[model samples]
Structure formats: C-alpha cells, structure tokens
Target chain A: GDKVKQSPSALSLQEGTNSALRCNFSIAATTVQWFLQNPRGSLINLFYLVPGTKENGRLKSAFDSKESYSTLHIRDAQLEDSGTYFCAAEEGQGGRALIFGTGTTVSVSP
Target chain B: NAGVIQTPRHKVTGKGQEATLWCEPISGHSAVFWYRQTIVQGLEFLTYFRNQAPIDDSGMPKERFSAQMPNQSHSTLKIQSTQPQDSAVYLCASSLQGEDEQYFGPGTRLTVL
Candidate 1:
C-alpha cells in the first residue's frame, strides 16, 4: 500500500469552474506540502500545511493529521491551471523526508 | 536569483551505457532531492542529500544507481548501466530544510535506446 495516496488521478474542468483534490495517508503525517508543476515543468510551492487550512488567491489547501488526509481546492480554474499537482507529507522529526503521492493531472479548458 | 540549475536538459544513451545527471541547488539550500518521473509511476524519490552528506538513498536501486553531493551547491546521480526502463524524466529539487516545500528545477529527460 502507498504511504500517501492521492485521489483523482486525473481531472478536467471548465474555465471559472471549481474542483477539489485529495490525498489520503497510510502513515501518520505531521505536515504536508502542495506543489503545482506548470506546463513549463516548473514546480511552484503552493502551500505548506501543518494539520490546518491555508488559502492563497484561487488555491486553498488543508491537512488533517489525525484523519490522515489533505485536500487542495481550486476556484475559477484557468487555462494556466492545467498541469500536475503533488502533495508530500512527513511523519516525524527524525530526518523524516517527505513521501509524495502520485500526482493529480489537472486540465482546464475553455 | 536563479533557482536550481540542471545541465543537459535532454540525454540519450545506448543500452548498458553509463549516464550522469548533474544538479546545482539554490545557493545556501542545505537539502537537495532527486526524483524520477514516469507516466505510470508518477514521481519516485531516487535519493537526497542534506548538508552535503547523503541522508537517505534507500529509494535508489542498489545495483546501478549512485548519488553524491560533493559540495553545498552541486550533486550528481550516476547510473552504472542504463536500461530502457530507466528512461524517464529526472527531476532535482532543493529546500532550506530537509523536509519542507522544496523548490524544483526543470527536469532532465533521459532516453535510452
């Protein structure tokens, strides 16, 4: 079983629409981080969550350690939102490197 | 400042040949990570370095994969014998801390024939 399992392996949305992405953890996660891999292949850090919720612009993310889950919400999806979204989680403080889940590919069209 | 830098955006090698990929992390970043991305497996952690030392290479294949961080700025991943299965995009990323939101460089695509 995967330590971190991300749902909605792929998603398609219309411009100005909204959607949600999720990640379920098999291990107890202490913190979670979300990233956006744009079409140019650049990974931009979207949010760093610590068992709570965070929102920036049209993007919002939440992490629940007790529930072992995290979510990314997109509002007013734009063409530029088409790319891959990845979530990584760490369990403890002992050199606990991040374990990433399979990314969710998002495509927004007209 | 220029973020992470990686050379040779595209690489092609023959079967059984050796391939080396280079990455230069952001200045003053203490942690660097390597990952291999494929359509099927998505992004797989390959190896990483912390404070110019190997932190964990458990994700790397013991037989043919080796990685080293010679200095604070640069790290290299070497494969002893390349195979078709090794053809994937190798991505490099760096973060101020060993575990956090890492900044990534544009991946280097490797093709084997």
Candidate 2:
C-alpha cells in the first residue's frame, strides 16, 4: 500500500473554474507540503501546513493530521495551472525525508 | 537567495559508465535531500544530510549509489557503472533545518543507454 495516496489520478479543468485535489496518508504524517510541477519540470512550492489551512492568492491548502489527509484547492484555474500536483508528507518528526504521493496531473483548458 | 541549484540539467551516458550529479543548497540551509523521479516509480527518496552529516540513506541502493556532502554549500551523488534502470530525474532540496519547508532545485536528468 502507498504511504501517501492522491485522488483523481488526473484532472481536466476549464479556465476560470475551480478544482480540488486530495491526499490521504496511511502514515502518521506530522507535516504536509504541496507542490506544483510545471511543464518545465520544475517544482514550485505551493503550501506547507501542519493540521491547518493556508490561503495564497488563488490557491488554498488544508491539512488534517488527525484525519490523516490533506487538500489543495485551486480557485479560478488558469492555463498556467496545468501541471502535476504533488503532496508530500513527513512522518514522525525532525529531519525525516518526505514521502511523496503519486501526484495528480491537472490540465486547465481555455 | 538563489535557492537550490543542480548542475548538468541533462546528461546522457552509456551503460556501465559513471555519472556524478552536483547540488548546491541554499546559502544558509542546514538540511539537504536527494530524490529520484521516474515514470514507473513516480518519486523516491534516495538520501538526506543534516548539517552536512549523512542522516538517512535507507532508500539508496547499496551497490552502485553513493552520496556525499563535503561542505555546507554543496553535495554530490555519484553512481558507478550506471545501468539503464538508473535513468531518472535527480532532484535536490534544502530546508532551513531538519523540519521546514523544502525548496527544490531544477533537477538533473540522467539518461543511461
């Protein structure tokens, strides 16, 4: 079984629409980080959370350690948002390497 | 801050050859990590260093894979007698300490044929 699992392996969105990606963790994750891998293959950090929610511009993320899940919400999706979204979780505590989910491929079309 | 930097964005090598990938962490970060991504495996953690000291490498293959952080500024992952299966995008990341937001490099794409 995967330690971190992401839902809807792939997604297709229309411009100006909204979508949400989810991650379920089998491990007792202490922290969660969301990243967007652009077409150029560079990972852009979107959010880092610990059992809380954060909003940045058109993006918002929430992590629930107790429930062992995390969510990333994209509002007003744009073509630039087309990429693979990955969520990684850190188990236990300090210095632990992150365990990444398979990732959700997103394509926003106009 | 220049963020994490990885050299040789793309490399092609014949099987049985050697490949050395370099990573320079953020100026003040103390923890560095290495990961590999492949179409079949998605993403896998290879190793990690804290304060320039090897902390965990459980994910690294014992045989041909080796990593070192000789100083705070840089680290290197060397693969000996590389095989076709070794082809993947090697990513380097850095964090403030052991548990913080990690910033990743552009990644080094290694192809062994």
lDDT of 2: 0.96
**What shift in Å separates residue A67 of candidate 2 from its native position after superposition?**
0.5
Q: What is the per-residue lDDT of model 1 for residues B1-113, given as tens digits with 9 covering 90 to 100?
A: 79999877999999999999999999988999999888888788888899998888878987999998988989999987999999999999898877666788898999999
Q: What is the interface RMSD of candidate 2, in Å?
A: 0.7
Question: What's the DockQ for every one of the candidates?
Answer: 0.64, 0.90
Cα lDDT for residue B26, candidate 2: 93
Show where candidate 1 strays beyond 4 Å.
none
- lDDT by residue for model 2 over B8-57, one digit each (tens)? 99999999999999999999999999999999999899999999999999
- What is candidate 2's lDDT per residue for A42-80, written digit by digit as tens? 999999998999999999999999999999999999998
